[model samples]
Target: MTIVLIGYMASGKTSVGKILAQKLNYKFIDLDDFIEEKEHATVKDIFKNKGEIYFRKVETQYLNELLALSNDNIVLSLGGGAPCFGNNMNEVLDSSTATSVYLKGSVPFLSNKLIKKKIKRPLIAHIETVEQMTEFVGKHLFERIPFYSKAEKHVLIDNKSKPEIAEAIIAQLF
Candidate 1:
């Protein structure tokens, strides 16, 4: 079945999704990357030039396109905010033989992961202080948890390795 990973930013959805897909012998796709390729622009670029509203519209459109070709063995990593828009989450749940898995993490853990990775995450990169990072992650996670709770399964990823996290999610799916 399609394993749809959903969670807040820096929650390791993409990382775990890759490992799960490899272990399960399924195709792996990051919804945001798919949208970026289709639109010929990076997500940051889309949010920069056309604004967030326009970007979200295109995101919904792209999601619909992806879901149309449904199958049982695909793995998808959704955007952090994808579930908050319209009925996207419901549609994703209803469409394919999909399993929605929420990778739960503590606010402190998420803050540390994001800071340590030094990735170009447009959202939280602006926070230069520990207090700001904690507050930002805490508030964001709090706001997104309601949406994330809609998932079919919840896996806490406090300090797990990638393979362990992926295996945990896989075990829950079966």
Candidate 2:
């Protein structure tokens, strides 16, 4: 079975996914990293050079490729905005062998985390203050929650360590 982790940026999808995969003996794949390796360019570079439309198109293609894998135990972490675009969330929901998990975090919790790593995030890279980050995250998360809520499982991530989050996911899955 494939376990797909979907959440806002910095909600620990990648970190918790690595731990979850290790514990489950599944291969771990971060969709952004996978795209970078396949395209020979970073996600930031793709956004900068090819623009978001191209990036979203390729992202959906790669996402479908990963979801179509048969008889593989995989832990896949999606980009923050992946579920919100196109029919990606429906595709994930429709996968027979895939289980989707939403890593849920509050606006304040996500904003604080995002503020520290805004430089690495293409969408909010220009956000310089906590207030701006909070506002941006609030609006974005509001719009994306409908898509994310379709996940098979929901895991609260605020104030939780990566190991704890992984264990929570394991409990939910098993």
Candidate 3:
């Protein structure tokens, strides 16, 4: 079965996913990277040139394509907003072979982790201060939890190492 990691940015989806895939001997795929390869453009470029609406459509399209694959023992790490847009959440939920896992983290923890890499994140790139980052994360999480909470399993990531988090996820799945 496919294991899909869903969570907000800096929730260790990619890092934990790599470890999880390694332990499970599964192939790992980051959905954003998949989109970049398919579109021949960075997600940042797509958002800059075509706008968010266009990018969201492409994200949904590619997500559908990935989910349609019959490959098993595959681990997919989704973008932060992947589940919140369109009917993507439902698509993930409806997939019989896909197991969705939410890498849940507190707003304070996420904000602390994201602050160092804020410039890399287009959505929160313009956020100026830690206070702003914290506030933004709090509000974003409030809006996103409804979608994220639909996951089949959740692994709390606060103060956990990447490997520990991955093991927790593995425990949940197995």
Candidate 4:
């Protein structure tokens, strides 16, 4: 089965996914890294050079490609905005061989995490203050919760270590 991890930026999807995959003995694939490898460009450079529309298109294409893989034991972590665009969320939801988990994080919690790593995130890199980050995250999360809520499992990420979150996911799944 393909276990898809979906959540906002800095919500610990990639980090927790690594631990989850290790515990499950599954291959771990981060969608953004996959895109970077396939496109021969970093996600930051892709956004800077090709614009978000083009990036989203390629993102969907790669997402579909990954989802179509016949590999049974794989854990895939998606970009923050992946589910909110095109039919990506639907594709994941409709896949019989895939189970999705939403690493649900509150706006404040997510904003706090993003603020420290803002430079690494193209989407919120320009955000200057905690207030601005919180406001942006609040609005963004409001828009994304619908898509994220469609996940087969939901794991609250507040006040938990990555390993704890991963263990929670395993408990929920089994």
Each prediction's whole-model lDDT (CA): 0.86, 0.95, 0.93, 0.94
Residue 48's lDDT in candidate 4: 91
Scored by Cα lDDT, where does model 4 land? Answer: 0.94
How would you encode candidate 4's per-residue C-alpha lDDT over 76-138 as one tens digit per residue?
A: 999989999999999999987889999999999999999999997767999999999999999
Clashes, model 3:
0
Better of 2 and 4 by lDDT: 2
Q: Can you tell me which runs of candidate 2 are displaced by over 4 Å?
A: none
**Which scores higher on TM-score, 2 or 4?**
2
Candidate 4, position 87, lDDT: 98
Residue-wise C-alpha lDDT for candidate 1, range 90-129, written one tens digit per residue: 9888875777999999988888877765458867767787
Question: At residue 53, what lDDT does model 3 achieve?
Answer: 98
Q: Which stretches of model 4 miss by more than 4 angstroms?
A: none
- lDDT by residue for model 2 over 1-174, one digit each (tens)? 999999998999999999999999999999999999999999889989999999999999999999999689999999888999999999999999899999999999999999999887767899999999999999988999999999999999999999999999999999
Among all candidates shown, the one with the greatest lDDT: 2
lDDT of 2 at 155: 97
Off by over 4 Å in 1: none
Q: Give TM-scores for every candidate, taking all chains together and pairing residue i with residue i.
A: 0.94, 0.96, 0.96, 0.95
Q: Could you tell me which residue pairs clash in candidate 2?
A: none
Tens-digit lDDT track for model 3 on 1-174? Answer: 889999999999998999999999999999999999999999989999998999999999999888888666789999989999999999999998899999999999999999999888878999988899999999999999999999999999999999999999988889
1 against 2, candidate with superior lDDT: 2
**Model 3 steric clash pairs:** none
